[model samples]
Target: MSLGILVAVGGVEFEPSLLRVAEAADIYVVRRCVDVADLLATAASGQAQVAVVSAQLRGLDAEVVAQLADSAVAVVGVTADTLSADEALLRRLGISSVEASDDVSAMAEAIREAVREPVRSQPEFGENGPGEAATSAEEGTPPGRIIAVWGPTGAPGRSVVSLSLSAELARLGAPTLLIDADVYGGSIAPMLGILDESSGLLAAARAANLGALDAAGLAVHARQIAANLQVLTGLPRADRWTEVKAVLFRTLLAVARRAHAFTVIDCGFNLELDEEISYDTAAPRRNGATLEALGSADVVVVVGAADPVGLTRLIRGVNEVMAAVPGMVPHVLVNRARSGLGWSAQEVTQMVVRATGLATVRLLPDDPAACDRALVHGQTLSECAPDAKLTRSFSALAADIAGVPALHARRRSRLGRT
Candidate 1:
């Protein structure tokens, strides 16, 4: 019995010679696909165990390769030059077996090699790879941390907290990447006074789709807002969420961890799981980006308003998120802690603890004047009001998270203010 193969060389003139050599070696050509869609459909039919694809094939990307891998179709990429940039790209696209298009004689061995390799398991996002040890040990760079700011409906200030936290962390000498992963409505670009029509997240997603997104590629997309703070702006329109795939988003986050000491994501309010009945299993979900961000986060900061209705929603939201992601213990942050709300910090903490069983709840004092000033100027609170209590609170939180001394956190805040 010969090994079944699907060939999609995309107009490469050497296909006939490669097929002749492969057939001579007992490799049968099951189907010759016209495009990536045809290749995928043919691979899914279970007739082919190996796919010989051109490195320059139109629409050939990591997602297509992933789908092929999912279908148990091992791929052997044929590039014009084995040592050229295309070969490197194919390798980055997770093609382990590659053959030079001009060298048709070695095609059979490449097919056998691809089939010999085991299907790769999905890597846990943010987990360090094998090569990370030597690099980290040499550079003395610790693994970066991811903090996802999420909240219940009714505007619990997720974006505010995310921006403030990232800015504060950067002010404390930690490099930070602020990502707006809100699928419903992402306002980070406008909030930061960035009027560019292009979105960093969307750009990064495109690079990821093409298997070209690395730390350097991500930095190209991210706009440097401060000396130590860079921001990956979110979607321009809510409906454009489908353009950002969840897997690619996870890959982007993993790349972000390599480039920054801290990544703060402003997540969407929804925690609903992808429904099986309502949508196709392979289709993109509106909340998929947010869900991936939360899952990849090292810390989930659940923010909520400090009012009666807000508190009720916060409690239920916390429970809902916990149910959606088991073993997730969030750090609750009650925003806008005003005396006018008729509740002390202790009372709010007690209420949150009694309902959500959280050990501690951080309070962010209401400073509408400072917030409004920052908003109007498109600057962070530290820049506008470094001495404000709210700014000090954020500095303290950053200090705690980054292991900076809190005793002089306020002084440092003033010193680090841009």
Candidate 2:
């Protein structure tokens, strides 16, 4: 069998020997990687069978190794100083074995073995996947439902809806955790009267990077706002995206899902991809956390304002999400819905239905007084405006997420006489 290999070993002295030996061993060199990032991008394409990478490769960690292995690419580390440095640290990352680059015999054997070994048959959400049995069993909670609340760049109330939905879910007796995953700018803590400067998401990310974040560790960082509601604050500054890596962010969200019945993320607005495409460096995308949340979410709530410009943005944003994310049923919510704009809800409904082809649409009435009051007091809309129409709308959202019927649904049922 012709084994495809991507070589990114350290030092120029080893490159010629690796290339020559790989050819001698019947291995076909698919790509010669310049750095760890290059190796990872190539490996994820599912073409390469094995990666002979350097043990001292910068940014080489368990998560990176796991991602490569997930793509069915077994990693083999080649190092000149394997005798001095402990191999145990790298072993945990699924490296088949570490061999001295000078020892051509051992290096060839390791590469050959990795190429011949059958890739493990595992689901995408393996033991570490979101809400998998291996993790939920330990947490003692029901399989959690993940909801990602996203909007466009104009700030159409993503945080408010996220917080109110979480609060209402907790009020309905489901343990809920609200995550401020807005890598652009997070306002969940200050909106909820949380004064703690410590960021729960950042702390969780650090622990996840070290492979130390678990259910108990997650529980410790989560700030309890109510009996069944918890909040994980986001980055205090937009520049703190460096602290939260994408892989670690996914792991943190998975752990959070295991610990709660419902995990609602107040996601950021941007969905643009990093276009630089570097072979030697990992370009930082400010919206990595947002993308991660959307990819993992079981349900996504797309919110927009009811005005002309807002609706236009809403339609464009929905199309972007539909084109970008697959396997998700998006629910579009037209917030601040009223008749002052000379277009009725019925007309707006038709426009959205024609534009996005989504059947699930909700119209939340425009109520500035109640929303402003809730924002000023740092309380959930359900708390300060108990009898407000907007609060009722948010409660309807929570009930829908919980798979239960609310007054709105009941009223609609009565009207339809179904």
Candidate 3:
């Protein structure tokens, strides 16, 4: 019996010729799809074992290729250009078997061969290890670092930390990207005083799902908040979490790593893998976005409230995150540290270390007034209250994360005390 084949080469003159020779090669054209959607539908029927697609097919991306592969259909990408400039792009998009020639017989043979071989998995993009510098594709410079700010339940101030850290990093002369990956509620836009009419995270997710998102595409969705800082807002509603798939979320982070000098994510609090509730292994998980961000981050800044109740949740939460992601050593940041707690930073540090085995611990002073001012103005602490003690701490924390000298504090001293 002839092997089944699906062809979706739009407007290619040689497609008719290729189809004529299919019978001789022991393959039959099962369907001639007009577009990617039709192609996917036909492939899902399991009637086709191979799909011949044009490199210029609309909406053709790695995600689509993955779907075809999932349906047990081998994809053979064809480009009209003899020089095969499109071949590199197709390969980058995860199509391994490609035919650059217009010769009908050669195309048929390529299809036959693609069916014989196992479909190879897409090559992982952005191979730079966590915290390692990536070579930017557009510019030959090293890409940015990624820092994830996460915390336990009961409002430990993850969003505030993420906003301040990103602002501080950008203020220090590094181009920064702040991402709101919190699946539950993303307050980055509102915290930064931007309208949340359009969620940048959802737009980017849609683009990634269509395999159309690149660094430039990401820029289109991100809103410019500061001279050097840009933000990708999160889901507009909590229930929209299912729209952001974990695999595509990872791809988005990879693009982010190359686009900015520092990418800070405000992650959701929940650490549950949701495997127990996930009857469909492929279904989206509520915590998938948070898990992916933590896994991709070079630095995970775990925030905890300084009070006793907060500390208990913090210690337990820290252990949970560490268990969820092995080899993850997070930086413990105790927020709203008060002298009234009957413990010094050292004591709190010791307690956290003893419980979680994480050594790095820093404290942010309890400055409700400064926090209120910043929040009221919808600005970062550094912007509204540069001289506030909390602002200095934030600057110092950003410096530690970015491996640079303290920024705003030094600038203030050089200009003389106000």
Q: lDDT scores for all predictions?
A: 0.80, 0.76, 0.79
Compose the digit string of candidate 3's lDDT tens values, residues 355-385: 8877678899999998898788888787778
Give per-residue CA lDDT, model 1, range 341-388, as digits (tens).
Answer: 888889999999999887888999999999999889888888888889
Q: Highest lDDT: give the candidate number.
A: 1
Which residue pairs show backbone clashes in model 3? none
lDDT of 1 at 69: 75
Error of 3 at 369 (Å): 1.2
Q: lDDT for model 3, please.
A: 0.79
lDDT tens readout by residue for model 2, 237-267: 9888777766777777777777788999999
Q: Which candidate order results from sorting by lDDT in descending order?
A: 1, 3, 2
Residue runs of model 3 more than 4 Å from their true location after superposition: 1-52, 55-62, 68-75, 82-93, 101-138, 275-277, 407-409, 412-418
Give lDDT: candidate 2, residue 242.
Answer: 74
Q: TM-score for each prediction?
A: 0.85, 0.74, 0.79
